[model samples]
Target: MEDGLLSLKWNNHKITFFEILRVLREKANYTDATIAVEGKFYPVHKLVMSTCSEYFSEIFERTPCKSPVIVLKDVRSQDMDALLDYMYLGEVNVNQNDLASLLKTAECLRIKGLAVPDEDPTKFRKGQSDDRRESPPPKRRRHEDSSSQPLSQRPVSPTISASSKTTPPSRTPPLQHQTSSLPVSQSQDSVHDSIVDPPPMVKVEMEEADDPDDGYSRRDNSYDGGSVNEGDGDFGTELSKSEHDPDNYGSGSFPGPSIQPGGDLPWDEGDSSSFPPEGFSGDLPAGQQPQGAEGLELGWLGGNEAFRCHLCTVSCGSSTQLQRHVMTHTGEKPFSCHYCSHRTARKYNLKIHLRDVHGVPIDRRFARY
Candidate 1:
């Protein structure tokens, strides 16, 4: 027997990360530190700041203060907010006019993974190969840190070093806010590149029909084993072509396929009354179409369903849609709320439930419902 190591990337990693960031931004719970920039206080997670910025990392490691308020001077509120956005999310946007200030703030805080205005903008794109992003600069000692104020008292003037920067200030209401929306005058492609991973390319092979003059080409309707992720039982099975056959219309207990426009279906040319002509049963194997069935492939119906659920009479228009739906019958829900016992078969439903029931912000990755 051979032993091997295996790694699995969670499909909802992005969602989970965004959810945690949402909690932090909302100051929902577990926040242990505050940062004051330009007199605007922001409640923040110390661990998150330490992990993202060496400046915060040094301050937390050297100082033994509880719930300390770090005063960051010479930084605008919007600039700090932009840095927070980049730290929590993977990107940030600032107006071209303010780009220099944002970059200076990023440099001051020693935040990596952000491109300078003069650098190749793609350097900070999310899908880049390196996980650690840019290399960290060498550590240097600062004399200004020794002359800083004590952590027990608030300083009238901000200190330049980590040791003197942390202190307790009178608690004030943090400005209620989401991420700062600094308008970018850059090209759409650059903004998109910085924020989103490039969409995966799908290779679709087209096949000519048995009759070349049929005026319709069939997409490779093969079942992709990869489509249904392994170890996810709630993903269910794909819908079958027979389930959506036009011939099945009015022939059985199943509903008719929605007739879309511009389709030259065999039934469209001939009398609709003679759809399931003679003794033809509407039932067929998963990927096999009914005999003599001719029409343009329903691309929207997942091209052709190559899998079928053995448990139910319910039919779905698309393969992935049916797979997600089948879990409702099996009582298998992979998506569960972090705050409650609410479980949902679909991730989108789980997100909606979180936003509506638990007050968590809607994930920016998902379209607003």
Candidate 2:
């Protein structure tokens, strides 16, 4: 074999890539013969043949004399160059895009066999798909994780990736949350007594004004994911006041005990209470603390930072002070076109911009490949 040429001998079959290259160089029968397999057809260039499975055998047998042979669907379409490389060298990685195509092509060409197929193809598909997904199996997860985690926590999500060419999702995370709101009432029923006997048509109660500060439209709070004790809480203002300020005994200062230190705990009560060396010293003093100390703890302030990096989420003492400081090294290109720049990180974003806004020449290259 020449330095760049490849050769292979299997049983009585002999194939040298140099032969095909010489034919191509001479333009002498270089064009592969075409043959139909199942619903599709492809050009078969070399005659090196093999029989592994029935489906493949049928396709291989049907290929006209000069047709080229492919490995699997995984290689034929997307990895055309790799397939060509394999045609010469007989090896390549089977990437996802061309896997099915290479397999289909191989099946068409009978690179495997026409019969003697696996008994349970569903198991085979499930195994391969499961492996490709690399997600925790439902049964394999801990009981809590299995019941609590969403399908996305596994190797894949319930829905396919938006960029996928087909219905079955690709390896990317299903990130976009598409919330579908349901109609409040099945019938066109108003808030009033739309019961058997309609109330008087006079408007009795004034309409409640929508609060500008509270912009979020109230969702149905009665959901499975809602807080278990949302409406009722044992530790209300009474418990909070007692815990934060134990100084107020039962003086007629007010209906409820006066808030001594005032305000609630920073962390959850259980977590904060755990550090109480003696647990609730319960010492109340004459309602007087030092200046700038009411509703504030000397333990806090200047000890540590509060606000964190908006992007990195690291702790920041003061966001205002950090604003210009953040520009020191983050090096993020803050300025960008509003439309396509945010949609993708690729420079070909201009293609999307042109297609979407300017009605310029459109190309589907980035849409998939």
Against the unseen true structure, what C-alpha lDDT does each candidate score? 0.35, 0.23
For all predicted structures, in order, the TM-scores are: 0.33, 0.19
Best by TM-score: 1
Candidate 2 residues 1-369, lDDT tens each? 468776664653334444554344234243332221111122333342221222222223332222222111111122233233233333333443333433333322222211012222211122123333232211121111123323221111111111222211112222222212211121111111122122211111111221121111111110001001011111111211222111111110100001112212211111111101111111112121222222222222322334321111123455333332222111212223443443332325546665677565676333211
lDDT string, candidate 1, 216-301, tens digits:
11112111101111112223222111211111011111111122223211122222111211111113322433333323123123
Model 2 misplaced regions, further than 4 Å: 1-32, 35-42, 49-76, 79-88, 94-97, 104-110, 113-369
Return the TM-score for candidate 2, rounded to 2 decimals. 0.19
